[model samples]
Target: MIPQPTPAAPPRPARILIVDDSAVMRALLRSVVSSDSRLEVAGTASDGASALRVIDSVRPDLILLDVEMPVMDGLSTLRQIRARPTRIPVIMCSSLTQRGAQVTIEALASGASDYVAKPTGQPSREAAVQALAQDLVPKILALTALGSPSHGSARGHASAFPLSSPAAPPRTPVTANLAFSTPPQQPPSGFAPAAVLIGVSTGGPAALDLLLPGLPAAFPLPILIVQHMPELFTKHLAERLDSRCPLRVHEAAEGEPVRPGHIYIAKGDWHMEVSAHSAMPDHHSSSAPVLRLTRQAPENHCRPSVDVLFRTAAAVYSGRLLGVILTGMGHDGLAGSRILRQHGGVLLAQDEPTSAVWGMPGAVAQAGLANRILPLNAIASEILRLSARSQREAPDLRETDPREAGASGIGWVTP
Candidate 1:
């Protein structure tokens, strides 16, 4: 008689350690986490100090760390956790206030994997609750040990959150569009970049800290970033990153001229784009490329969408723009990235294993739009390698039609 094939073993539940001073918050987190069978509340701690004490014993694969605890707050705890021999991923819990934003930025810089905003003053409690659940649970599943699939899920939002106690983890989704290899011909012989555009979300702050330090201060291109964030948080994140990196990083100012060797971060809720014409004499040209900010309607449900900046820059910079899609939770950068590629721009993605959530990069990779698929560490060097050979004078910025230069008529909410 022919024997039936043996079933494969199920993935072990992701062990999570919850640390919060408030008993209620800890309980709430536990309830949400334990409700999913794929996750297990490995242990709980009242504060960072207690967490440090029990951390080794519980041996959790991920941590849900709270920002403000009485003794040894989240940032301090994060430093200690990072210093440990074993690298356990920690997600911080943060308040949505300005002060909270500042501290949360610090936590991310301190090496916490990612963060979740605690519902503070939203108009409806249920709305806030649902937001919290939707935001926190999926992130936990994606960033935890449980989230790393042997193959990448094209869109983590769709299949990441598992409700049933299935015997096995679901296979990662694959799509025809994901880019597999660097385009054989792009970044053509005489390529020189006028600017570098980056789109990141989910685990961006920490990812930036790790990635940015690898590039030198003398790096030639002015790097612009669209990190999914709200007001106050983007400013704080830029401040935190600037202090650590050799390069100068700042939150993008509406009228500021783009300059080499500096990084401009997109301000929260505003679409940061480049003006084809710089009204005043500037470093790069007689008329410099200017920074423009608008409150355009959200793309991929994100304001300051990666596509907006990338698509606009493609018009202004021609083939001189380098588009990079880092770790993020959605496909925000894909369509915009396509526009850049069509215009001869070179696109790069952070490979799946190194990314906190491969959603955004995966989208680009699956679409076969990325010119290069790189790990976080190698991207900086690749930037340097590509920029060193870039053309000295940018293509006529005026070549693109004036109509594409302005994002004026689109619906935008007042900040």
Candidate 2:
């Protein structure tokens, strides 16, 4: 008689190390981690130092680090963790407060993989738990790839999540076949862009640190960015970037006109779009396009979504826009990139090797939406080269110089 075949054993759950100063928070985090079948808490520590002590023994697949701690803070501990030979992903658990946001941003720049805001204004424990589950769980599954069927060993885990954005929107999931169906298309030739729009998430802060500093002060087009982060965090991020960038960086303000040589970051919790300023008294002419921040429902599970910005910019700049999709967890910018392309705008995607999570940019690349898939280091030079080309090759499109428009309070002609 033939024997029945043995069934394969289920995959082991990804182990998590929780490090926070408060016992209550630790317990709450433990509950959250345990709620998922794919995740389990390996150990808990009261501070960064304590975490380091048990880290080797526990051999956690990922670490949930707290920014502020009693003995050794998250930043100091992060430096140590990064210096280690083996790489373990760390997600900073930060409060929604300004200081927490600041430190979290710094931690992200200093090698912390990602972060989640601690629930502060929740009405009840259950509500807080639900919120944590929604935000933190997805991040954990995305980072460790424990939720993915393709995930193999601990060292070579694959992502379970798709492309997406910050206070941006819930990501719209596309099957692998549909996402990569289209072959790479050639970029439109003899095209010039008047403004540059960027979408990034997950590994954005650090990626921006490398990309933004490279753009010279004389950058010809107005630059707008959507980064998945909360409110106070966006402000601090803008400040941090402003200090390092030659071009002025701002957490986009409401009603401010978009200008060349300036970088505007979508404010956290607000969807930033462009609107033509009110028409002149006669009503035939209108002023330059100004930023409009809204509380519209988040697209792709994010508020300051890349799609919103890209779609609106397409209308304002028409064929003269440049959209760049950077490293992010989900495909938040994919739909917007398509709209931009439909409007004859150019698109650039960050290549996989340089991305922390290739979800967002990868989606664009797979969809055959990107005109150029480039590494992070090369993007700046490309932008410069394209801007230079706009000046030399597209004289008709440059009917009014951005400087003259700024001085005269004029706007784009929608050419």
Candidate 3:
């Protein structure tokens, strides 16, 4: 009989430290974390101070930190955590209220890896647990790099959410003919980008805090952004960014004119698209694009999906568009980026090292869709450089049929 080879030991589950002032909340989070075999609860802390005291001993792969806690609050603790040499990923567990959203944004800007709104208004404890699991578990798996065969059930739960597990299969294109050939490594000569569309999630608030402010108020192109978030949070995010940036930033509204020097963030729960509005003969000769918002079904398990926005922007702007995919979880922007690239649009992806989770942008980068992959800090300068190019210096590439340009029609779908 042939000797059997020794079985290799399985990888250890990622350890998590739960920190919340409420014992009940801590217990709930522990239950959620424990339900996934790929994850283990290393310890629990009542507040930020306690968490800081035990962090070294617990050696958790990630932390689920509550925004409002007794003693040292989440932000204070987060700042201290950043001061430390060892960096552990911290996921802010916040309430769905306005104050919660405000504080969560601050924590994110301060260096929290990501955030999940605590389940509220669910009819039952089980329902609440399910909601938390769907939101929190995938974040754990993504930020901790814990995707494995042992996490089967956990990954399945995550599939019900917007962020897909790493073990999941590559997403199928919405249309069969949408298959891409050799995507251009660089835009064709004379590619003059008239508009900049950005898709970001996961670590977006902080990334945006760093990015939007970098663009001077005089930045020429209109910027449309899709940041995966719920309703109230998006509003608060807009308010926060607007106060800090030189350029005007606001939550996008229906029928607003898409104008240069202003930034529009897609409203939470509403898909934002652009449409050409024929100018009144008395007012102007050419049509101008206006923002259009819809209550479309969620794509990639997300409302206000990046693909939805990208697809429409590509159609409205055609070859004159520039699509930027930033730090995010899952592949929300991949399909859109593919379609945008097909339409002679330029693409930029945030590099992995600077990303909090790298799922969305990584997909674009891996698919050969990105014309450039730059660090978080470099994206603003590149955008400025691209937007400043003379439109007349190079003839617009929009005249070429996309199919003839080596791509096919975009089949937009919500799934």
Candidate 4:
């Protein structure tokens, strides 16, 4: 009889340490991690002091840290852990509040690997649990694969990536039509959208640094963005972008109207949407469009999920909408893009060469979702061209046709 090879030995389980003040939270995490046979709950701690002691004793492969603790919070714990030169990967668990969001960003900056939003009271337990398992677990696995030695170096290198190069600011204007042959389909009622929606993550800050400043202050379109960032970091990002760009930029308020010449960022812990307002008979004052913000359950494991914003825009704006998806780590925006495409809305994605992580954009591109995939530098110019095209094609407008406008006295300006 032929000898049979013995079954391969089972792989070692990844040891994990759970740190949280709440007994319930600790139990929940333990249960989840334990459910995965590849993961083992090595130890548990209530605060930073206990966590630090456990870290030295157990030397776990991963740590799930809660941002709010009685004695020492997640941020303080992260700092302490990093200072000791231990290389264990940490995933931060945060509440879906503005303050919580800010703290999560700080944790990332300070050296925590990744974060997941702790469910707010409003969302059901099932939704909250799903968000944590889907989003946080994947991030933890990805960060751990980077290994301890390379983690610090990767962070430093990523930070140094240029926001925008000053020398190439005024290169040849790359129009959208020239880059892609197929023209955007004419809207059903010839109604052009008044605003643009953008969803970006991972390399977003750097990409925005290049794109935002190129836009003119008088550019007559409102822009709503759902960038994957911690709450506090987003405020800093807005301030930074506002200073550099000519347009007004601010975090979205609960019920603020979406208007031209302004940018609204989705606030941490709340999903932001644009809705139509009933037109008053008077028509004298500015139209009061309603902007909705909700503490609803996260979609695709993100509180201010790109999918939520994109789907809402697809429904409200329909054929008038322009949806742009940028570099990110997962397939959060794919479903929403399908909605946009079905409604005759335009879709754009960042090219893979310029992406920090190509997972998000790649999914869209591979599935034939994006109408145009352009380099990071060319995105702003494409937006300008598309907006201009929409305006020129508007049925009610008596403006000169684009072909005639190009041949005639009106000079095409790139902003």
Candidate 5:
């Protein structure tokens, strides 16, 4: 009898480098990464310094880093890695504690790719292990397999696609592909806009890093952003964007008048709302909308939720608002975009492949809410085209030259 033929061996799993101070953390991370057949832990390091030392040998495609460590912190390690020529994506594991959240934000600004809040052992905490698998695994899978054709489908592992945000059982299946097959296209016309409101989460930091820098220095209208992050991280992101982009970027402050030629990032841990003053009673009042910060209960399990900001902006700006839903893991901006549509506003979404996770944008795209869906590279230029038509015919409002707005330099207002 002829011998039976054997099946070919499976492809090598994506190698992962685990870096953390705690042995338990490293072990847990390893288990999570290895849970799938397509991923395996390549090496372990107790600190950033040690991780750096072994990077050459391990030659990992991805790194799971702990934010705090005795010998070398995550941020310092990230900085050293960024200085090198090789480009490897890093995911940081940070605790929900104030300090942990803040430091994690700094790491993102310092060039870390993404982050996940460390699950706590307390009974009151969410399931740490489950959250890690659901959140971290998908990110690793997506980032490592970025341009691979086999992405976005169930590939024998949970990390093969972007997972749902906030750590829960997925409400829907992942997309089949994240790419745009056609060339970048222009959006519809006839609508004029006063301001830009963007709602993003999960993959926001890196997406914004790519987008904000691409806009022209003379880009009109202030851009209001709601990125689901801890307080310190939001502030750091604004600072980082300010340095990189032509637009003056800063954290949204209470009573600050939203203006043209600037970008206002919603402060972390606070729900950002747009409240019209109709010309405030104070002498400092302007016709522009006033920034309102509140400690309202979290929506969609987040304080500075995309829903909160988008809803209020829809109400305040009405048909004059321009809302864009970028990459995120949840449907936070869906309802808000619906409101924008109700008021005759324009909304755009980032296409799938460019998004780290297509949840937010997909939500709008699937619902038929987005007026136009463009690739990540195309969205920046579309913003200019969509808004410029109205801007050209726009009537000038009250303004005093700060000298900064005249140029592409940074602008600041004291609270």
Candidate 6:
């Protein structure tokens, strides 16, 4: 009789260290990790100090780090991990607030591999735990495959991501006029519009670092942004962006106006809306426009959710709104882009090759919601051309001189 064929050994499971101040969080993470046969919780810690000590013993393949904790916060822990030069990959867990978003961004800048928003309420909390497990397992496995040899080297070029650059004085507006004409090949079934709204996450800081500064201050149409970040971070982002871009950048405040030559960012915990309110009579008996913010329930598990901001813009600004979804995890903006497409909004998504996670934008493109998917480098030029075309067609009288606008109290340094 022929000898029985030998069977191959199964692959080893990934080991993870769970770190959070709450005992409930630790248990929830353990339950989620254990549910997967290919992942195991090697150890757990309630704070950064204990986490470091636990790391020496378990030598986990990955870490799930909570950003806010007693003793050592997530950012401080991340700094410590990087300082020790541990090759272990860490994924930060954060709240969906402006401050939380800011800290998470800092953690990523400091070397955390990626981030997931912490659950909001009880039911959402349970969902977030399950989602975190699903998201983390693959990242942990990938990091292990990349190995420690690549880990140290991977960090050497951290600054190469392009989150910020030195500011240059605003250049003279380009006079090139591009014409708008519907191509013979139009979007299928849906009406295509001339305007765009953009949302980004994770690698956004770096991506925006490149895109925003490149746009001329005189960019014609209004641009609305919803970047997934905590409150303090959004404030910081606006301040940082204001310094670099020729266009006016400000954190969206309730009742503020939205206009061209200006960029409005969603405030951390509030949803921003672009509505045409009945114009109030001014001193000259002319109608004045207004923009409003609402303290609405979080959409897509995020307040200031990209979907909420984009969907509202699509409803009011349809056929005039261009929607662009950038790099992020989860499917938050997919539905919104679909709404935009149905309403004649132009759609663009960042290509997977350029995204940090390629999950969010990838979903929209795969679903055929995007009209044109391009790499990060090409996005600004596309927007510029589109804006120029819109300007030629409409010849907007609301065009504000960017330099003069910047000087009119629109640009203020946040202390």
Cα lDDT for residue 224, candidate 1: 95
lDDT of model 6, residue 5:
86
- For model 4, the superposed segments whose C-alpha errors exceed 4 Å read 1-137, 143-160, 163-193, 230-233, 278-285, 390-415
- Count backbone clashes in candidate 2: 19
- For every model shown, what is its TM-score relative to the native structure? 0.79, 0.84, 0.84, 0.57, 0.72, 0.63
- For model 1, how many clashes? 13
Error (Å) of candidate 4 at residue 244 is: 2.4
What tens digits encode model 3's per-residue C-alpha lDDT throughout 61-151? 8888999987898889888877775667789999989899988888887778789999888998788888899989988988777743222
Model 6 C-alpha lDDT per residue in residues 167-223, reported as the tens digit of each score: 312322111121213221234333323445778765566667677887765566667
lDDT to native, each model: 0.76, 0.79, 0.78, 0.67, 0.74, 0.66
How well is each residue in 146-241 modelled by candidate 5, as lDDT tens digits?
323322211122221222223323333333332433322334457678889999876687678778887655666879999988787788778878
* Residue 53 CA displacement from its true place in model 5, Å: 6.5
- Residue-level lDDT of model 4, residues 44-85, one tens digit each, is 999988999878788787789999888999999988876654
Position 236, candidate 4: lDDT = 63
Candidates, ranked, lDDT:
2, 3, 1, 5, 4, 6
Q: Give candidate 3 misplaced runs (Cα > 4 Å).
A: 1-3, 148-184, 278-287, 390-415
Q: In each prediction, how many residue pairs overlap at the backbone (N, C-alpha, C within less than 3 A)? A: 13, 19, 0, 2, 1, 15
lDDT of 6: 0.66
* CA RMSD (A), model 1: 10.0
